[model samples]
Target: MTDGVTAAHGTGGHGEPADAPVSAWVLGADSGGSGLRITLAAVPEGGAPQTVGTVTSTEPVRTGAQGIDAEHMLAQLVPAARELLERAGERAQAAGLRSVCVGAAGMATLGGQLRAELPAALTREFSVRRIALAADAVTAYAGALGQLPGAVVAGGTGLIAMGTDLRNWRRADGWGHLLGDCGSGAWIGQAGLQAAMRAYDGREGGSAALRERAEAVFGAPLSGLPAQLYPRTDRPAVLASFAPEVAACADRDTAASEILRAAAQEIATAAAAVCPAEEGVSVAVTGGLFRIGEPLLAPLREQLHRRAPHAHLTEPAGDPLDGALLIAARLSSDALRLPQDPALLSLT
Candidate 1:
């Protein structure tokens, strides 16, 4: 909480009261499958931006549920944002908290009561005059490309590819785990688990090491796999957890290596789907997949070369939290003029 610490270090003057308006700062947050990331910066009149606070907290995963689950999702999001608001203290009233922008995982598919609920909660809590809500992938692209005309592949628990060249914009994948999200962590994990089950039954000529690993995790014969998954609320995360193990075993297990190689291909193909194979476009790669290094990246690099050789590939300039801030800034000016999508909620 950078801003909180700085505010606390200020003069002996009293802090802003809880009931006052937060009018001087802009906040950006990334809400994802596992957690929430928030960053705040104060924009004083005619002065350089001063970063004040940032926070990371756990939150519910959005699995594309449209009704009651959407309310439940808001139930999780409000508290994380509230924590940041409270950090601003009475200074929220003094500095006069301004606008907030939030990017969540399934925002592209968002609608219904949940969409309406989030902005109301933010306004009431932070007393900000304006709010912007967008798909985390939108911010991811902006943050990764620095708002340049390029494409970005965001590979985390799920996967999505988005690209823009001012004149046109395109998006691909991000269909979620049930139908798509190929080359995502959940996708790789599912592939590994299926291979393990096949080896257990001698069905796929799978790797013994993979089978042994599964047995060790799920008990002998692995008969309890369904029991482990069926009753859990966080089934996707549970399944996606296996991806790290798959990547770890890729060097010693054939099935694991094949799963990673295949996952890489699928993700690369997704990137190519949204980005044209042109000479001028540059693509940035982000998310946990990049963190796994060569085991996954080697194949992805090869696939990208083969699939979209004319496009350039590079590391992201910043994470999604940064994207949130970048877009919020854009909204204030006409910077890159983000397109209006129904999934996005803009309150001013």
Candidate 2:
């Protein structure tokens, strides 16, 4: 940890204490389509850390809106995250916090976009060093499986598949909202919208489950959906928010069911691409899409199993924030060691 001078770099309610001991503070951040999440944990060597707390913020990107540039999204999000870290540090100070670690979206892949930009943003706001950044998927992958080599599929506002061979790593399908996020929430919503459009055109002769659900939830008629959905800043949510209703209609409506089935296929394909064809790979599913239950996971698992017979499946042990903290704990001059904390055990 840095001296109080470095810790006192930014202006919040209170600066760092002159006499505070420099301990380990673990912070993880997930800046996804829905919003932003910051988790803080206080870890002492060989000791279990008491939960400090979590700070929730918003992603710079609007849930469903299009046309907003990446720069604009980062501008809005970077400040919120900085404020969150400062806030967490202050809270940890009140509760006794010393070091911090962060796991956030864009941290891993959005290099010029997030890596350099974020560190500068933080330093401008606070005196912080020892920051470790990785793909949000890394946190999820690590959190779900600990140091073991495995693959994780996240189907949320965006879809991304990643895996580590415990040595080598690979990833695919994080195309964002425009090109293709194959197995993402955006994909599901977009597919659902297509189904609705087809139904409206009479090209398809069934009630479009996605369209009906969107109408029910947003109180917006299906006829005017594109107009309402496209012009707004939160298009992803406007579309994805209907996910539950789509799931409900999947069994009863062919169009809706087909959309879900297609999503499962895409996810399975991504999983296969990330994992080796050889047996014994571990795979796990997480994110908002899986929360919808069997409508998604069951089909996805079945498809993956058919492709890779020896793969193992498991539920996420802890959230990605925990994974971020776990990553921080592992980053060392040499190698990371397991802490005595029980809460952290789940992360590994």
Candidate 3:
């Protein structure tokens, strides 16, 4: 129906104008523990693609026998994609709503395991040309550098660093909050609380500002935390909420300063580890922790200088959501080249 052409539709904020008709459309979605985001965009015959609609909502988590739970992602992705197309009225379906590309957490390793369930779950909702899925990390790399080869460090509630030389893919830490995610907001907050509690216990000295922040977060002195934190559900999220206050205390608070510095070093270590030794490799960073640029990035850059003197640090070209959109675009266009191979998925 599209005749190999596409256009965007829907109405309202982040959506297309009510009067415009779209030739074809596709969705790019990014799903994580926090939420799911989808962008509906238009692809045309000989012109650039444009985003016409954006939708976001929380979705149910799906489970599998091996703990590969991409079905949780598809549950949300399917409904959202259908709803957006419906908003475009009968025109969009008639013109051919093409495909959906998902950049999701835990998807990279799932492979055919996730793919096997796609048709039953997604096609039942709407007809599409095809669906392509990859790990959120893959989308981060593709979204950041496009066809250009390099590494990306995405640190938000969690942390992950990945790089590619077009021939080989290199990856560093992203082990989630418990085992790793050294530079993540969750890490920063938890560490800040522990330090403040140590000072409260008279075991160490900490920043007054951080201690105050911790008290505010816990609704009591540091002594009260151990009981609540250990038994609490959603501990990472609860702890991460205090990260901003810790970042705010930076220069004037020694404990805060040290925490930020340590976080910066951890991020730098991951970023540096993934980049190839070869020169001209660019490193881009994305995450909430990096948002407090000076208190964090200044130290990160310095550490990277010492660690990988040649790697260039730069702002992320886009966020994971943007990366997801880029992935959708690439999947629909054969003319667009990607350097990915099976080995990249192996993360060898």
Candidate 4:
């Protein structure tokens, strides 16, 4: 345990002796799909988190492309992480840093690819001593609940729900756009597009009205979507932005509304599946789709109530950056004791 000061790797490379005494630090990175964001924070002796530096990176690679060459994406992240650390180190020279943690997407569940890559790359450049790599969802959990046994349902291009029993953890979904991601943006947009096509062909089940709207939105019929929507190859990232439109159309179009309602049920089911049916469970809803307000959350809450009647849903207290800082603080203490309220470090 660190009594007052400690030493760790710097932005240059890992495994190197720390140049200065240690204080406490946190670094959080959310990468994958469209862009990456790195946040560096410094926690003074007894003070709250203060921004040290930040960096942003983007990977145009698709999930399909990542499956073939994830290294390409890693290349984009490593440099940004290094940049943030460099700035953090300059600030840390005055305060000292204890630990660094990374909460990145497409890294945790897809094998240890990014896990090993991140450490190796950082070590080659910085002096990071204690480093933790976890799923962005896990980081979101820590940020939203701060070690509590709660779940977070993140709906963007992908939909996933993760929860912890404190000692152990369980995850419900997040199969990606191609496979599942029921209530995700990709799912909504894809469903909308498909309905439009069916309307054009007179083969659509019940999406006639929604189909017409989709055609109006996209100019030509749904068939033109493949090229118009995903012109850059980052199809999921491109398609994800339209999820809100689908939710908007739900009330106006029977087929669209049914699709949205079903999606809510599917997402809530995934969230509930991971949450034990016992009492005193906490749940939070986040992501762009939910930003549309009641059209999403109210339905999702109703669906979750069907199974876990006592589950409580709240807005996320903080974001991934807060989680990174909390994890770093815990590592510095070596007791994993995070702040009682992660929201205390909210970015905004």
Error at 293, model 4, angstroms: 2.1
Worst 10 residues of 3 by lDDT: 1-10
Give each model's clash number.
12, 9, 2, 12
Model 1 misplacement above 4 A: 1-24, 43-50, 59-95, 114-130, 276-278, 344-348
Q: What's the best-to-worst order under TM-score?
A: 3, 1, 4, 2
Each prediction's whole-model lDDT (CA): 0.70, 0.60, 0.70, 0.64
By lDDT, the candidates rank as: 1, 3, 4, 2
Could you estimate the TM-score for every candidate? Answer: 0.78, 0.71, 0.83, 0.76
lDDT of 3 by residue, 238-271 (tens): 7788788888889788888888889988988998
lDDT of 4 by residue, 1-348 (tens): 101111222232122234333457656565555565666665545444455566665544344533323465556555655555665556654443456676666654452454446566555545566666666777777777766676778777788888766655677778878878888888877777777677788884647766666667777657786678655776776666666777777677777777777888988888888775568778887766677677776787888878667788876767766766666656655656432212111110
Instruction: Name the runs in model 4 displaced over 4 angstroms.
Output: 1-23, 45-48, 59-91, 109-113, 120-126, 221-232, 235-242, 337-348
What is candidate 1's lDDT per residue for 1-348, written digit by digit as tens? 112222322110123333333235677777776676666655443222244566666644545446324555555455645555577666644654467777877675654544667677667766666677777888888678766777899987888898776555688888889989899888888888888888877895567777777777777877779788879887777778888888889998888999989988998788888885558688888988678789998998899889888888887877787778766655544343666566643444
Candidate 2 residue pairs that clash? 25-99, 27-101, 29-103, 64-234, 64-235, 64-236, 65-233, 65-234, 65-235
Q: Identify the runs in model 3 with alpha carbons over 4 angstroms from their true place.
A: 1-24, 45-48, 64-75, 89-91, 109-113, 119-127, 339-348
